[model samples]
Target: MKLYPIEAGNFKLDGGAMFGVVPKSIWNRTNPADANNMIDLTARCLLIENGDRLILIDTGMGTKQSEKFFSYYYQWGDHSLDRSLKKYGFHRDDITDVFMTHLHFDHCGGSVQWNKDRTGYEPAFKNAIFWTNEAHWEWATKPNEREKASFLTENLLPMKESGQLRFITRNENNFIEKSELDFGILFVDGHTDKQMLPHITYQNKTLVFVADLLPTAGHIPLPYVMGYDTRPLLTLSEKAQFLETAVKNDYYLFMEHDAHNQICTLQTTEKGVRLKEIHTFDHLFD
Candidate 1:
């Protein structure tokens, strides 16, 4: 099996929103903010190639929103989903599965795109089965007031409409173990309902797609949770337990939002789990 880091694009968000209760003096040291107080964030996705299946985790924010809508996020960078796929000698249609961690606009917006005529939207990965759990699917479809803005219809409805949506439920043992992929799913609810993280075992190493649970190495400290999380206290507990498990297993965290740091290892310190080392994906995998 081979894994590739796909760069969908970069955007900016309010640093205060991203850091939640953490003071600017602390988070700013790691993720410095711009003059507008927005921090740089990347919609970095992951691609896995195994046998006949090519799976893409998360699609980043697509380019189908109105200019006024996009004006809010302040997106920048030339990196694009299409361009990233082409970098790996593949195309959008070549993906066999799209495993969405959640249905937030930044995470799954690229799953659907505007059709040729712009009359309607369609599944961006023409031949891929879009994967999400039943709980998350329902939560995103009928979003609450706080999360409604993040779960846009244009980013989700088209997959089901295209007859390519599939639910990744637990097996008899209450674990997601797909024999095709060299990984298992770890479901957490702190960030959103049933957010799935892929715990992949490759080349005698366990590399986890951290997703929003641990957006960057800076988030390693227990209290550095995102304000966007629906339940902050629950996030604290989840992070504590997950960090302990990550340390026990000596896992490599594949960060999705950290623009400068791609992968990091954890070490148990007096202050709890902290980043031990940082390495590029190619530096470690290649």
Candidate 2:
């Protein structure tokens, strides 16, 4: 199996929102904020070439939204999904499976795009089966008030409408030994509902695509949870359990939201689990 780091795009989010109740004095040291209090973030998607199935995890926020809608996020950089795919000699049509960690716009937005006629939206990857669990599919479709803004209809619906949507059979435990996509899936609910984190064994090491469960290396601490999370207390518990397991197994966490750091590992420090090391995708994978 071969792994490629796909740079979907970069944008900035409010540091306060990203770090939750954690005071700026603390988080600012690591994720320094801009004059407007926005912190740098990236939609770092992952592409796995396993045999004939080229699976893509998360598709970043697409370019279909209006300028006014995108101005809120303050997007930056020229890195795009097509450019990144071409870097690996691939294209969106080449993807066979699109495994979404969640239905948040930033994660799954790129799955659908405006059709050529501009009449309506359609599945971006014409050949890919968009993947999400039945539970999340329901939750996102009928989103609560707090998360309604993040779950845009334009970013969803089209996949199901296109008849390319499918769900993974979920297990009762927080971790699935092996998902239909041929990798372990760690299901956590603190962020939204049933966010699936992929635990892939590649090149003799375990690399976990830590979605919002651990957005950045600065979020390694137990108390550092995102304000967007519906259940912060549950997040604390989930992070505690995951961090302990990650440390024990020496897993490489593939961070999806951190613009500066791509992959990180944890260590058992006096202050609990802390960042042990940081690695760029090429530095470690290549």
Candidate 3:
């Protein structure tokens, strides 16, 4: 199996929102903010080429949204999903499966796009089966008031309407040994309901796609959970358990939102689990 780090795009978000309750004086040391207080972030999706299947983890924010809507996020960068795919000598049509961690706009927005005529929306990857868990599918479709803004109909519905949407069978435990995508999944709920974190074993190493559970390297300090999380208290407990397991197994964390740091590993410290090392995808995988 071969894995590629796909740079979908980059954007800025409020540092305060990214690190909830954690003072800027602290988080700023790792994720420094701009004059406007927005910190750099990227939609670092993952692509796995396993035998006949070409699976993409997340789609990132697409370009279908209006300028006004995008202005809020302050997107900046030339990197795009199509361009990134072409970099690997592939295209969207080649993707057989699209495994979405969650249905947040920034994570799965690129799954659908405006048709050529601009008359209606359609699945971005026409030949791919868009994957999301049943619980998360329901949660995102009928979102609560707090998360409603993040779950846009334009980013969803089209996948279902196109008849390419499917759900992964989730197990009762926190981790699934093997999923239909042929990889392990760590089901976490602290960030969102039933967020599926892919645990891929490649090149004799376990690399986990650390989605929102740990957005940036700065968030490794336990208390620096995102304010966007619905259940902050639950996040604390979940993170503690996951961090402990990550340290024990010496797993490599593939960060999805961090713009600067691509991969990281944790080490047990007096303060708890802390950043052990940072690596580029090429340095470790290539």
Off by over 4 Å in 3: none
Clash count list over all predictions: 0, 0, 0
lDDT of 3 at 233: 96
Q: Which ten residues in a row have the lowest lDDT in candidate 1?
A: 172-181
* lDDT on C-alpha atoms for all candidate structures: 0.90, 0.96, 0.95
Q: Please list the residue runs of candidate 2 whose C-alpha ends up more than 4 Å from where it truly belongs after superposition.
A: none
> Per-residue lDDT of 106-217 in model 2, one digit per residue for the tens?
9999999999999999999999999999999999999999999999999988999999999999877878988999999999999999999999999899999999999999
Residue 208 local lDDT, model 3:
96
TM-score of 1: 0.97
**Candidate 3: residue 135 Cα off by (Å):** 0.6
Query: TM-score of every model?
Result: 0.97, 0.99, 0.99
Give lDDT tens digits, candidate 1, residues 54-169. 99999999899999988998989899999999999999989999999899999999999999999999999999999998889999999999999999998988999999999886
Q: Return the candidate ranking by lDDT, descending.
A: 2, 3, 1
- Highest lDDT scorer: 2
Better of 1 and 3 by TM-score: 3
